[model samples]
Target: MPTKTKAKSLPDGQLDHHAINEFKDVPIRATIEENKKIMEELFKDSSDIVLREFDIENGPKAMLCYVDGMVTTSAVDDALKALMILEGNAFSIDRITEQTLPVTQASKIQFYKELLTNLLSGDSVLFVDEQDTAVCLGLRGGIRRSVSEPETETVVRGPREGFNEHLRTNTSLLRSKIKSPRLKLKSFVIGTETNTNVVLAYMAGIVNPKLLEEAEKRISRIHIDGVLESGYIEEFIQDQGYSPFPQVQTTERPDTVAAGLLEGRIAIMVDGTPFALLAPFGFWQWLQASEDYYERFMATTLLRWLRLGSLFVALLAPAIYIAVSTFHPEMIPTNLLLSIAASREAIPFPAVVEALIMELSFEALREAGVRLPKIVGQAVSILGALVVGQAAVQAGIVSAAMVIVVSMTGIASFTLPRYNAAIAIRMLRFPIMILASIFGLLGIIIGVMVVVGHLAKLTTFGIPYLAPVTPVDMSDMKDVMVRAPWWKMKKRPKYMGTSNVRRQRPEPEQ
Candidate 1:
C-alpha cells in the first residue's frame, strides 16, 4: 500500500496525522457511524467531500461518500433511488452491490486503503449502518482536455491525433495503432501521496525479457511522495544521471510510442501527463522524425541528412566563427576577411564575447516566447532577435558577421526535431565557444572529441547509445543513416536483442 506522512495540527493543538501505518491495515467497522467518523477525520479539511446520508426503504440506513464534481451526480442519484426503493429488509453490502444498486461497476472494499484509493479516483463509496464492507462505484468524471495535435511534434504526413493527459485515452490511442494481442500494457501504481498510474507498454514477444526486467526493476525502485508527470519517472529510471543526452525519449505522439514498442523498446506512460517515455533510445534517433516513415524513403533520407547537417551547424557554427576570427583569420579569403575586419573595427568586444552576448540573448528570447502565450510568443521571439541583432550591429556592440553566425546557429537549433536533443546541443555550444576563445581551433577539436567519447561510452538500458553506428551493426543501419524503404527494411533492430527479428517477409521477385 502507499504511504502519507504529513501531519496537520488540530484546533486543540493536537497533531492530526494520517500516517500510513495508522490506516494501512485498518479494516472497516460494522457500524456506519464509526466508518463515517473515520472517513470524516481523514478528510477533515476537504470541503469537496460529500457524505450524503440517506435511509433505504424498509431497510437499514446508508451513506454515500464521494468528491463533488469528480463523480457523475446523475449516476449517484440513480443508485440512491434504486437502493431507497428496495423490496426487502436485507442490508448486507454484498447484497446491495450484487442485487440492488443500479451501478454496473460496483465492487466491495474491506480495508481503508482500498477505500481511500477508490474514493480519490473519482469513484463513489457506500457505507451501510450494519455492514463492514462498502461498495465502490466507478463514476470517474471531471473536465479533461480533448485529444489534439501535439505542440512539440507536429507532422504533416502522419496521424494528427496525439496523446491526451488521460491515461486510458493515451493507452487507447496506442492500441488503435498496433492492433495486436501481443501489445501488452502492464500497470503499476507509484508515488505514496499521488499514487500515480504508470503503464509499461511493449510488444510481448519482441521485447527482450532481460530489458523488460531491468526496466521494471528500475521503475519499481522509485520511492517518492508524488509523481506529477512522466518526466519524474524518466529521471528516476534512466541509466545515467548526469548525461545531458536523454537516455529515454519523451513524445506526446502515440504513434511514436507505438513505433518504439514495435522495435522492441518499452514505453513508460504516467497518469495526468501526455508525454510517454521510450527506453533504449539511440543517438541517431535524435535526428529521426516521425514523418520519415510516412513519406518516400528517398525524401525522408534527404531530410534526415538535412537534420544531421543542421545538428553540426548548431553545434559548431559559433565556435568556428570564434576560432577563425580570433586565431585563424588568415584562413579566410582576402575580401571576406577585409569585410569582417571592417565590421568589427568599431566593436569594443572580441569575437567570443560578441558571440556569447548574441547567443545568450537569443536563448533568453526563445525561453520568454515559450513561457508566454502562443500568439504573442512567436512575434516576440522573431522581432526580438531581428531588432536586437540589428541594434547591436548598428551600435558597434557586436560585428554584423557575428550576428549572422549567431542567427544561423539559432535557426539550426530549431531544425532539430527533438526538444531535449536540441537543448543538449545548445548547452554544449557554450563550452565549445569558451574553448575556442582560450585555445582557438584546437580547443574546439578537443571539445568535440570529448563529446564524441562521452556519447560512445553512454548506454540506455544496457544498449549502446550509438547503436548500429559505434557497434557497426550493418543490418540496423537501414533506419539510422537513411530510412530504407519500408518493404526493403525487413528486420527489427538487432541491437534490441529481440527473438522476433523479422518485421516482414522478403518481397517476391518482381
Candidate 2:
C-alpha cells in the first residue's frame, strides 16, 4: 500500500515560502518518494505512468518511474541490462553513490530539486529504497515532428534546416555554427503549472549586461499557469503593450538566432515551441536576410533597396491612389488622371470606397490561400486574384485603376523578410486609407509622421527601435542601407554595446 499524507494548512504566501525553503533541504530519496506519492494522488486517472522495481544485491531495492510513451523501449532495455544483467558484481546503491557513479553512461544528480526536475522532464529516475539519494539517467524520448524547412521563412539560397521543438536540438544547432567560448546559454523554468523550460542564449562578451539582466527579470516575473508558445512570453514582456508592431522578432532558423547572438543580441527558446525570440530588434533588421550575407554585396544591396522601396508601396500606394483620384488630381500626370477618371466614371462607389473594397477582397483571398490545403492553395490564390480582379472591373463594382493599385500593394508587402513586420504594415494600410478619404494627401502625411514619431520613441529593451538611422551612425550605416563586404564590416553595431568593436585587424598598409 502507498503511504498518503493530508494537506498541510498554511496561507498561500507562507505555503509557497515554505515550499521553497523545504525544497532546499529535502533528501533526494525522500523527495523522489514524495513526488511519486504526489503524482499518484494527482494523476490517479493516468494509467500510462509506469513504475518498475528492481534490487541491488545486499543493497536497497530501487524503482524506476517514467511515462510509457515518453521513453524508448530500446533505451530502457539497454539501461536495465547494464544495471541488472551484465554487472559482474552484485549491484549496490552504496557503491554507486554520487561520487562513485560513472558520468560516461549515467549522470549523477545530487540535489532534491534537481532530481524532481529530471523526473518531471520525462527521464526515468532510479530510487534506492533505503538510500538517501536517487540517480537520474539522462534519457528522454517523445514524439516530435522530424526536422523540416520552416514554413514561414522559406528561402531560395540558404541552409534548409529549421528548429524543432526539442530545446537540446535547437541549442545544438546554434552551437554547431558558433564554436566559441563566448557563447553562453542560461536556462530557467517558467509557468507554475506547466513548468516550461526557457533558455536565454547570447554571446557573453558581446551582449550588454544591463540589457540581458532586464530581459531576465522581465521573464522571471511572468507568473502564469502555462506558456504554450514564444508569443505568450513576447506578449507578456513587450515594451509597448498597446502597439501592434512586434518589439521582439521570432524565427525558426537556428542560423538567424546564432547570427543575432553573435551581434550582441539575445535569443529566447521556450519548451514545446519551435519559434525562438530575439530581442533588441530594430526596424531595419526585418529587411535583412541570411541570403544577403551569402550572396555578392552588389546583389544584396540591390535586394535590400528593393525591399525598402516595396515597404513604402505596401503602406501608402492605395492611400495615395485614393487621395490623388479624389482630392489631389493635380499630382497625377494629365494623361494618367484622364485614364483614372474614365475608369472611375463607370464605378458606383467613390474612389475611396472602391479602393477599400478591392483591398479587402485581396486580403481575404490571401488569407484563404494560407488556411487552405497546400495542393490547392497556390492555384486558388493565383486564379482567385486574376478572376476576382477582372470580374470586379467588368461588373463596375471597382475601378480598373483601384485593382491595379491593390495588386501592386499586395505584391510589395510580400517582399518583407519578417512576417511580423509585414503584418504591421498590412494593418496600418486601412487606417491610412481612412485618413486619406477624410483629409486627402495631408492626412496621409500626418499618418506617416505619427508612425515615424512612434518608432523614434519606441525602444526594444533600451536599444533604439530605429537605431543607426535616427541617431545617424555612419559606421553602422554600411550594413543597414547596403550589404558591405565581409572585410569592410570592421566593427559591430555601436548600439549593441559590444565590448570588442573591431571584427578584423587593421591592414599593414594602414
Candidate 3:
C-alpha cells in the first residue's frame, strides 16, 4: 500500500519561506502543477532554468525542468519529440522509458529533495500530470577543457594525456591504462552545500584493506559546506596537520596516478578539479621524478644522486657559507680564505646579514615574477635575479661570494621535479640561516637535527616518513637511493599497502 501525496497550496517561489515542519516528509505529488510550482520556487532567481511544457496526444501532460548550462537543448528536444509522437491512450513510465525516450540514464524520483537535487545536478526532471513519480534524464552538457599534457607535471617521454576537470573523464583515463576488474573506484558525496563527489581509487587485491578503511573513515568524517579543490580534501584527511611537509602527494598526470595505483597506493579524486591526491607517499619519492623510471636505470640512478646533492645545496648552502666564513675560517684553504676576506673587507654587513638581504630580495623578485603574466614572468625572474645580485655586489651591499652562494642555492631548488616538495626545503632554509647567525656551525647542527627528527616522526597515513633508510629496508633502496634495473627489483616495499608483492619474475640466466 502507498500513501497519496497531498498537494500544498502555496504561492510560487515560497518554499524557502515555509517552515521546515511544513514539508518535512513531503513526496512527489500526483498533481504536476504543484510540483512545477515547487521547482520554480526553489529555482526562482536562476534565469538559466528551462521549463518546457508539453502534452501527449492521448496521454498524460508533462513538463521538463533543468538548469540551462547543464544540459544539451538538442537532446532534450529529441526526447521530448519522441514522447509527444508516442501512440498510446495513457502514459506508462516503463513504456515511455523503454521505447519513447532515447536517454541512457532515466531514474525515477519519489521525494521532493531528490527531485530538486537531480534538477540542479545537470539532469532534466520530467514531471507528469497524474504520476506520483518524476523521471530524471541524464543530459548533462557543458564546456569543459579537453585533456592535454599538464603544464606542471609534463614529462619528456610519457603519456601526454592528463586528468581534466570532469570526474568521469579522469576515471576513464585511469581505466584506459589498467583494464582490470581489480581496479575499484568507490564514490562518496561530500560537502553539505556543494555535494562534491570524492572518489577513492585503488587495486582491490593489491591495496591493503586497512589502508582503504582508514582513508574512507577520515573522509567520511569531513562535514563541510564545500570542497573546492583536492587540496581541501587532503588538508582534512592527512595524517599530520601541523607538519610543514605534504603527507599526501598531488599529481595532474594519469601515468603517475596509474603508477601509484599499481604500487598499491590509494588515489583520491575530487569532482570539479583535475589534481588528484596519492596517499601513503614517502620522503624519497619527493626527490624522484616521472622521467626517472622512463630512462635507463643507470642514468636515472645518477640523476637521483644529482637531485639529492641539489636538495642539500638548496637547504644548507647559504647557512654553511655563513658558518664557515664567520666561525670556521680555519676550515677554508689559505688562498680561498684570503680571497673571501678581501671580497668582504669593503662589505657594510656581516656574512649572515648579507646572506639574509640577498635571499629576501631574491624571494621578493621570485614572487613578483610568478604573479606577473607568463610571457613576461620568466624573463623578469631571470633578469631581476641577475641585475639585483650584480648591482648589490657592485654597491658593496653584499659581497660577490654571498651572491654566488645565493644564486647557486636558488638554482638548486629548481632542480626538484615537484614544486610542493621544493617548498618544504625552501621554508626551512630561513630558519637554518637564523641559527647559523646566532650559534654558527653548532647552531646549524642543532637546526638540522631538529628538522631530521621532525621528518622521522612524520607519517604519511601510517607509513614511516623515513622508511627503507631509517628502518634499513635494503631491498627498497634499489629504487630509493639508486634506480636499480627493473629486472633486478622483484619485491615491493613492505607494510606500505603493496599486497601483490611480486611485480615481475625474471627468468634465471645460465
| lDDT, each prediction | 0.89, 0.81, 0.85
Tens digits of lDDT, candidate 2, 165-226:
98888888888989998898899888756778999998987888888899899988998877
The stretch of ten residues in a row with the least summed lDDT in candidate 2 is 13-22
> Each candidate's TM vs. the true structure?
0.95, 0.91, 0.93
TM-score attained by model 1: 0.95
Stronger candidate by lDDT (2 vs 3): 3
Write the number of the candidate with greater lDDT, choosing between 1 and 2: 1
Q: State, as a TM-score between 0 and 1, how close model 2 is to the true structure.
A: 0.91
79-134 per-residue lDDT for model 3 (tens digits): 89888988654668877766678899988878766666566668899888999888
C-alpha RMSD in Å of predicted model 2 compared with the true structure:
4.4
Clashes of 2: 0
Best by lDDT: 1
